[model samples]
Target chain A: MAALVIAEHNNQTLNEQTAKTVTAAALVSTPVHVLVAGENCKAVAEAAAKIAGVEKVLLADNALYARMLAENMETLILSVAEKYDAILAPASTSGKNYLPRVAAKLDVPQISEILKVVSADTFERPIYAGNAIQTVQSPAGKKIITVRTTGFKAAAEGGSAVIENLAATADAGLSKFDSEALSKSERPELTSAKIVISGGRGLGSAENFKLIDKIADRLHAAVGASRAAVDAGYVPNDYQVGQTGKIVAPNLYLAVGISGAIQHLAGMKDSKVIAAINKDEESPIFQVADFGLAADLFQALPELDQELAKRGY
Target chain B: MGSDNSMKVLVPVKRVVDFNVKVRVKSDQSGIDLANVKMSMNPFDEIAVEEAVRLKEKGKVKEIVAISIGPAQAAETIRTALAMGADRGILVKTDGEVEPLVVAKILKAICEAEKPDLVFTGKQAIDDDSNQTGQMLAALLGWGQGTFAHSLELTDASAKVAREIDGGLQTVELKLPAVVTTDLRLNEPRYASLPNIMKAKKKPLEEKTPADYGVDATPRLKVLKVSEPPKRGPGIKVKSVSELLDKLKEAGAI
Candidate 1:
């Protein structure tokens, strides 16, 4: 049986993370099956079928899956689990919410956020805030895993796969859909962006995040925040990047006024290039940064923006 | 609502070095030895315990039970929870670091026996920084889960939990018998009062082992070595802010 890669997408658009998940799946097994579960998600299933190395695309479309409720998702996935050797999902919020349940129901160990598949059963993952790497061996059985998209490339297009429509299961009546307040952003998502410009408490206020915004806009980068900035109410909890928050690995990570704590470093230490701009030379962020600038961000922002513009970002 | 159906809440706590203790990770990276490390209840788990106690105080819950799977020393975390207003405590005694899935399985067995109306845990333990246990427990118990919850409210038979998502907050309404893993922002945990501390000493703390639940706490992951991250190269102090800007340009850091 092939590995099943769960596709993360709404009916209208597909999240690129789904492709990266496919890339992770390819490392473990060949002929991956992409599962797209949602109401009227045929387009997503169709698109997933085109991803390279995808052997089949499975679709489970029903009103019960409209919100991707955990209860219903677990039941639906478990019903089809018998056919797959491994089940994988991108470690997005949605995937994190449901994959563990699937792993538990199957009574199997789940390798979360696997950076590499050393063998069929052995895997490598980050522990101790990415300060240590743990090599784990899963119980030799059907595997359940969540792939961190940042560690793998997105699967390219140009494959033809069979699309199979699967049936949805009865709702478990364990949860109800409440309203959601998703922040709409014209900028790229922090996880997918090549460049990320984040601010810290030094940004001063929530209103001052706009200063980092100007620089991010010029570079077309995503905006992020330190836990201090989030705790100080400079940004919402969603913008936080730390041990307890989002993990992002981008090509270039620029930390502005952010004194890098170990917890914060755990989140973005994997970035290809790290740059810290802080007035304090002793700030811990400089320890991990490839480049450090000792300057007041208040004065540094406009100049950096002008320079980036001159370079034609 | 006054009947046994009134929710029974379970909160799990862990004792770790206080966040303020400037952790100087050992030079060899043989793993952070807490032999002299000052420890306290993990900050996020404190919020979970506080949320549970508040729900009980609000009459939204019938009882709050605090549980910790750690060395006998971890009873301190349970006592702290009791001092904060938990009804009782359970200590799943284990020595050394246990793999997360093993801990989840043990917790799952306990949950099966106790059948809590709700389960709470810190999003991740500060030491291991593995955010897998609670989600694993929820999965094992076949229960709904909400991670990184900053705010939660319980209605008659459902819970309204606001989980911090990627770009914003997602308010999930889960029926009773759900799992919630807390973050640091959940609430300001109350310090234990002297009187409450005295009373907490009297609360029941049942001790059990993973063997009692027919669960194995064996580790699947082996730490080959723990080492400090590579030392960053020496930094050059730019002559001035202008020189700094020029340096940043040269380094392509701008």
Candidate 2:
């Protein structure tokens, strides 16, 4: 038996996380199958089939799975849970919401946000908000896991696999979709972005945070914020990159006007290159940064923007 | 508007290291040193407590029951919740760290008896950072869930919750008796005053063991090893933005 990866997609397009999850699946065994459960997800199923390591695609396109609601997903996964040795999903909101449910229903222990796969049974994850790393062995028959999308390289798209239709499961009838207020952005998704520019409470106001966007736009980077910035109404909750928010490991992560809180460090400390700009020279962010510039962001913004523009960035 | 003063709210709090303290991994790499560490209520749990108290004060809720699962010292965490106006607390005593699944099972047992109309918990504990307890409990109880909820408006039959989803907010209407996990921006928790601290001493705190709930505290996953993350080399200070850009370019960070 092989790992069955739950594909993350929004009816129209598959999320990059599905490819990353496919990579995690390879760590377990070959003959990986991507399960695409959504309404009109044939294209997403085809995309899943193209992921290099995937041997097959399980498509359960149904109205019940339209929103990836836990109620719907829990049933869909259990309907096919018996065929696989392990069930894996990207640690996205939808994944987290349903994986645990599926695990509980299957009476198997579930691991959250695994950073490394030591073997099919052993894995490493961060505890104490990434301050301590623990290698754990699941002493169970079935393995249920949520793979941290940023931890693994995405499985390249170049294969053709057979797509099979799965019989739909009954809706649990316990929950309903009311509405969604998704944050719309032209920039890249924060988790997958190569570069991220994050701001904090020091930005002062929502309007002042535009300085972050201007610089991020110049580099085609995703804009992120600390919990303080989100709580201060400077940005939406999804913009938060920290222990309580999205964890990111972008190629270049620049912190502007943000003091590195331990929780915040837990999210982006894995970035390949870290840079910090703050008025306070003693900020903890500088401690983790590979490059530190102790300067007022207000004074530095214009100068940095000008330099980047001059460089045609 | 919903029925005022009839609903019971349940808030689960976790005792964790103070948010300000920098944790150090132990020499043997078993885990972080906890001896002499100053611990407090998980910050997001504090938000949950505050939200519950606000609902009570607004007459939308009649009772707020706080629950903590850990060692006896966790009672202190519950005291803090009571001081924050949780009305009462129940400390589910255990000696060792219980994984999220077992913790959820214990809570499920208690919820079966308490029959709270609502359940609130921190989205994730800063300690384990597992982010699974509430979701698991919701799964166990077959309750509607709104994880990472930023705001919640209550009604008679359901709660309209605005959750922080990637790139935006997703508002869901969870029917009554739902599990709502709090995020950072839910609400600012007020500091418990000196007087409240005194009053909280008299507040009832019931102690129970996992056995009382017929649940096992045994962990499902075995810890193979524990270690500190790789340390980043000390950063070099750049004198100016132009110099910083030059350094970034040289490092191929741009």
TM-score of chain A of each: 0.97, 0.99
Report clash pairs, candidate 1: B29-B226, B29-B227
Model 1: residues with Cα > 4 Å off, grouped in runs: B1-6, B17-32, B220-254
Error of 2 at A77 (Å): 1.0
Q: How many steric overlaps are in each model, in order? A: 2, 3
The TM-scores, one per candidate, come to 0.92, 0.96
Docking class for candidate 1: medium
Among the numbered candidates, top DockQ falls to 2
Q: Rate the local accuracy (lDDT) of all candidates.
A: 0.82, 0.89
What's the CA error at residue A150 for candidate 1, in Å? Answer: 1.6
lDDT of 1 at A99: 80
True contacts kept of each: 0.46, 0.77
Write down the lDDT that model 1 would get: 0.82
What is the lDDT for B188 in model 2?
89
lDDT of 2 by residue, B1-254 (tens): 24778999999999999988878888987777999999999999999999999999998999999999999999999999999999999999998778888889998998999999999999888888788888889889988788888899998888888887765777778877889999878898999999999999999999999999998888889987889888999989999999999989998889
